[model samples]
Target: MSDNGTNTTDATAYDYSLYYSEDTSFFTPCNELDLKAFASVFLPALYSMVFVLGFLGNGLVVCVLVKHRNQTNLTDMCLFNLAVSDLLFALTMPFYAHYSAVSRWTFGEFMCRFISGCHHTGFFSSIFFMIVMTLDRYMVIMHTHKVARYRTLRAGLTLSAFVWLLSLCVSLPLMIFTEVSGDLYGLVCIYAPDNRAWKFYNVFVTNMLGLLLPLVVMVGCYSKIIPRLVNMKTAKKHRVVKLIVSIVVVFFIFWAPFNISIFLQFMQREGHLPNECKFYRDIKLAITVTETFAYTHCCLNPIIYAFVGQKFMKRALQMLSKWVPRIHFPPSRDLSEISFRRSSVTSKSSDITSTIMM
Candidate 1:
């Protein structure tokens, strides 16, 4: 359990583990293998796929939102912002992919900081906007009368500004601490805290804000929404319930494992859990694998939230058709029917569903 002879060149291969404690320094080198060898091959390919899909899917969402900016409502505004956040997140993947593939930080110190900042900012902002969307849905369904005045275009802009500012603030620690430095793995970009406390702080912040808080809010909001949807006899109610369930289920499925893995690692580093070498290696591998799954959640955002919407798909296809003249797409039967309303209190439950989804 000494750093003198142990080869930790492969430790902490990506930014995901930048906050992880250097426990390799204490790990006994008995029969040690290159745990990160799998990462060098597996992660680059997965990251590349995530980057391409996230960029294209989110790019299309952005294009559609912009094309109809004048008609955007609170829901549309949230979707637009979410897509932008994912786009920002997707842009950082290639740099990380290169770092993973080669185990070097060739992007220099500034990019090291910039990309780290951008990555966390995107992550925080995406989750924050989803929280906003959930609340928006709650208000529209359960407190329709009161939400009208507050769900305006002006209100959405203000909320978006606040969320962006907050996300930047939350990510500042990683931004300020991240640097490119020479390590056993050669030059690497990492969030190198000066003390173990700072490392622990990073993990605590990510776990609380990135997963725990959002999960609570989502569960609370959807609990009210599901019963409300169930009480209604309209056919559209089923679709609304289905979409709500999908959102919550997908978010948990994609992110929970990753968060749990890192939290366990943090606990082990704190000596609260057994520190056996086999357990340590397993947890590290789990972090790498689960982090890859978590990163791909951004790619699924557009699909679950936007593309599945009948009206949104129609509009996106119409936009695509115009861009590619050879490909014909059926125009929306009645664009006016899909227009956003200033209030939904007096509207039917089905109308509320369409307004939120469309």
Candidate 2:
């Protein structure tokens, strides 16, 4: 037996020659063909649709948040940052779509780095904001007395700045390593590590810091929140807790498999298991789909937080009533001052009530 590229290996392989042999036919079970077919038809469609939807959805979120900036709270600030990250991520999806469509990257070196950098930046920022949101929820639910001191608008802005800075730091390696290289027909943007160990290191860092740790935090926060909600006497507050819990559940369900798949792929690449196994191939395809859906989780958050959490639709309608064509109101400084004072008083009262309740 000699090494060739045809024969499919079982779940273990130390050397290439273990699977491929000179006596074996050049084409066995059409493994590459199956993989190509799946990648060609499925990946392009999945990436394209998710890209379009995510772009539009996140764009709407940004617009709505901007429009209602006066109503911004700590939660809204987190949502705004999340929407920005998603929008940037969605912008990069076209390049991925092009690659999937043509089975290659035609973009040059700078774009390759930029796109990869943006991808990592968006991913890190998204996860960071999510973790912050979970902590925000925890403070509001479990540590309400402390939220007023730490969860202010200024604090949220500072936290968001830190998130962006952290994301930028994490993503710098992508800019350094990713480049467009291959044949004329099939350029790929990949991290050209000095050694295989470096590749595994990159995968492990991304999987652990970017995905797994945040997931654990989210689950832990929501677990405590849910039990408290169940015991709450206030039905309205319970509903809000349930809604937040649902968001966390949805995030976990969408992202958990994608992150796990990255770990598995790293294992396969490191020769921990044979890549030629049918199970590996099938799981790879599942991973592609799962990742596509997981990335779109960003777009869903704005809807959950804005329209659903804050009743943006109804509030928008109320705000629009003042703009009817024939409606006119005489200028009244006294009334305006009274309204402003009333709002300030109401807000202070609500804060006091919340503090006392806690």
Candidate 3:
């Protein structure tokens, strides 16, 4: 058992610390030299690449969205919030990259808590916004006239604020418990509460809020939407259906493995799985690989959620042309002409605007 009566050691309990020194007394110190060496090289390089791509992509989305803030609909607002979440998430990559490469937390206690808080806040916020967007699409498509008045700019803003608040609430425990303390190695930033219950809470929150809840919501919403789209005769409906499918599939593909790995570790702690050395090493490796895939989703969000939309791409090019006068972009199609008109749906549904419907 751990010092806190948990089966998890410092590094195993939470994934924040990438490497552990073998001198730990809380558990049998497993020599992880091979894993440490691999992470030192692998994590820094991949994290740097992700930071560059995710920052640029999400940054462009923010610029375009802010420029068109007045014209934004509920969907656009959700997309904007999503971009902000990804940017927040991306900003933490460099810190973690440095931590992994050097195998220590040199940034101090404040940053350790702050970065951990930001990382979880961004994660939950991003997922929550995606859920919000999904439900928004469902309401606009399925409920139509019933939700029309409530889908206004003010409502979107209110909902966005709520999501951020909830995300912060969920992340608060992790932030409070996270500290820069001396491990067997140098100082490491980790969730190191004395109570083992907090460890369970950490994993429970991650599994339930981050994965299970979102998965259920997406599945429920999309199941209703698919059949509705199938019955519709418009080509626009067909395209919207495809985008919806892509959103759901991509999310699970990138996130499911990571969540599953966390869950398995939780189960092992609960004595539901074998707690052997090989299992420990294997699970750690799985978490590392799967987490990398999950991180890349921030980079993909711009393409999946915004760039796929013709109107968004046009606006982006227009913005680009303005910022770089030397390079010319083709004149975009007339906004009035390109705006999608949903057939046979209520006028409120038609109000969804081409800003989001790809």
Query: On a 0 to 100 scale, what is the lDDT of residue 317 in model 1?
Result: 92
lDDT ranking of the models: 1, 3, 2
lDDT of candidate 3 at residue 147, scale 0 to 100: 89
* lDDT (CA) per prediction: 0.80, 0.63, 0.79
For candidate 2, give the lDDT of residue 148: 67
- lDDT string for model 1 (126-173, tens) is 999999988888888899788788888888899999999999998897
Highest lDDT scorer:
1
Query: Model 2 compared with the native: what TM-score?
Result: 0.77
Report residue 228 deviation for candidate 1 (angstroms).
Answer: 0.8
lDDT of 2 by residue, 251-279 (tens): 77878787777677656555676646575
RMSD of 1: 3.8
Q: Given candidate 3, what's the lDDT at residue 87? A: 96
Model 2 has how many clashing residue pairs? Answer: 0
